[model samples]
Target: MGWLTMTRMAMGGHETPKAYLDAQLTYERKAEGDTPFQGLRVLKSVYSGSTYYAAAERYDENGKRIYVTAIICLVRWNPRASDGHIFGYKDMDEDMGPCEASCPRSVLALLTTTSHPFALDWRRRCYRMLALRERRIADGDLIRFPEPMKFTDGSEHREFRIRRDGQKTVLTLADGRGRFKISRLLERRFEIVREPKVAKTFFPAA
Candidate 1:
């Protein structure tokens, strides 16, 4: 064992994989207004080499129970610092399936057993919510104009300002002359504007 592992063990910090997952999920629930998840019950657990996998039933916000799987690998880092080593499972990988469809047979074999009925709606809402929260414009976010810009809305602009137009997020000229919509493209990425090839890349303000 490495020095870190020895220290963690000496500190009496070992924790069952199930216990660690439950704690992590609880933290997520509290952050999202404690909705979408009624409860979680682990159905089966298996170990392969240094990795641990678990399958469970998760009740979503709509009171629908669905099958979920998680994979955790042992690590030496202590995320809580003071909290004794719980095997560092902060980066567990998760997948949700009704089990009958969607999941691979190899992974399903671990679960030993699935509704994806709300899969589409739930995914859309989850992504939109995450985008709105994380991809939002904040002070010091970078904005670049590679060329002069024009808008179909007949709005003129020299600089941009971020604001919301109802449920949609928009970038309006700082002078309030023109506006354009911002879209979430993929995880942690946004399409600010395309016509002028303006780059919305975010660089930490120096």
Candidate 2:
């Protein structure tokens, strides 16, 4: 997937799309030291509005998968608030939720800002709720909310669903508070091709 598509997948309220894109690029640049582009792979889950799953994988020189990390970005829309709060999680288990077992701190920081306490709190609550729901679903429990549920002082109530297509899983989000339309889901996977110059910069001593 292209950077524009990745930007769209990671986009959230409160920041212009361009701003979000810039931040994501900066994060990716900083991550190159630890995870070189040649070994990095990106996989996406279903995207509904501003909520989605993004996973990164690192492969060793022999093509063995060495590490995997996933992030679930949940954006809560509140009309009363100027901009919606964005939350992210790097610590999540597979089958416990839409997130993967590997959690990376850098991924989580992409969506969180320490300057906004309210947004930070919102992200924390949402992360806990999704983690709990993921566990319940994995235990063969059917999860369906009969009523719209409020999240973190937000004016809107939200609902989530998981759909399995062959080997692929797609997460769906619905706005139950009324008059809010969910965006169409878009999913994509991309491999980061390593550039020799980039690798040299990251490992100059090599």
Candidate 3:
């Protein structure tokens, strides 16, 4: 419904929240000793009319977590608009705080980043994980989230995932929970947004 559809593999009715996710995501398992939490994610599952990327994550006290990350690229939406852009991030931390978010108004006033990776523990995420394909931070200044900044592209960020009855290409990412954020550099300033995405699939060889 929102920019991204978030789903966490069930982990035993909240009791073993982390374990249940592991079982549900048998096809997307990560290596052992990756992180202290467990989570998974699938980005850009539906990239049609309302396009964006889907991201999700799950955490547990057993030191097991999974994060799913991917993008739901749009095939055709307002074709006349400029080519869409995807922000490249190396790592995200809780210290980033409620990065440029669009959700319940409570997020705007509450201490959202108090527990977030980018805002809380940045080093563990930014310096450790998160490999970026592109970096646009050089274009503009770092603008904090919640401060209204416009994205010119026609495709507004609204992420969703459609598993449907059975689809093969539905790729689930496999990795740890890395803090997520987005930055767009203009002529003299850069704008930052909050975009957290985790992987649901595990690449043992990777």
Best by TM-score: 1
Residue 139's C-alpha lDDT in candidate 1? 33
lDDT value, residue 21 of candidate 3: 28
Model 2 clashing residue pairs (backbone): 90-103, 96-134
| Each prediction's RMSD to truth | 17.4, 23.0, 24.1
- TM-score-sorted candidate list, best first: 1, 2, 3
Model 2, C-alpha of 122: deviation from truth (Å):
12
Off by over 4 Å in 1: 1-19, 22-35, 61-64, 77-86, 94-107, 110-206
- Candidate 3 per-residue lDDT over residues 93-188, each given as its tens digit: 133332322211222222222344444343233222222213333211223333333345432222212122242222111221122223421222
Candidate 1 lands at a TM-score of 0.29
By lDDT, the better pick of 2 and 3 is 2
Task: Please give, for residues 32-109, the per-residue lDDT of candidate 1 as tens digits.
Answer: 564443566555554433444455556665546555644433434444666644354323334332221222234445
Q: Point out where model 3 deviates above 4 Å.
A: 1-27, 32-38, 41-55, 59-78, 81-94, 98-101, 105-206
| Whole-model lDDT per candidate | 0.45, 0.39, 0.29
Alpha-carbon deviation at 47 in model 2, angstroms: 1.3
RMSD to native, candidate 1: 17.4
lDDT of 1 at 85: 47
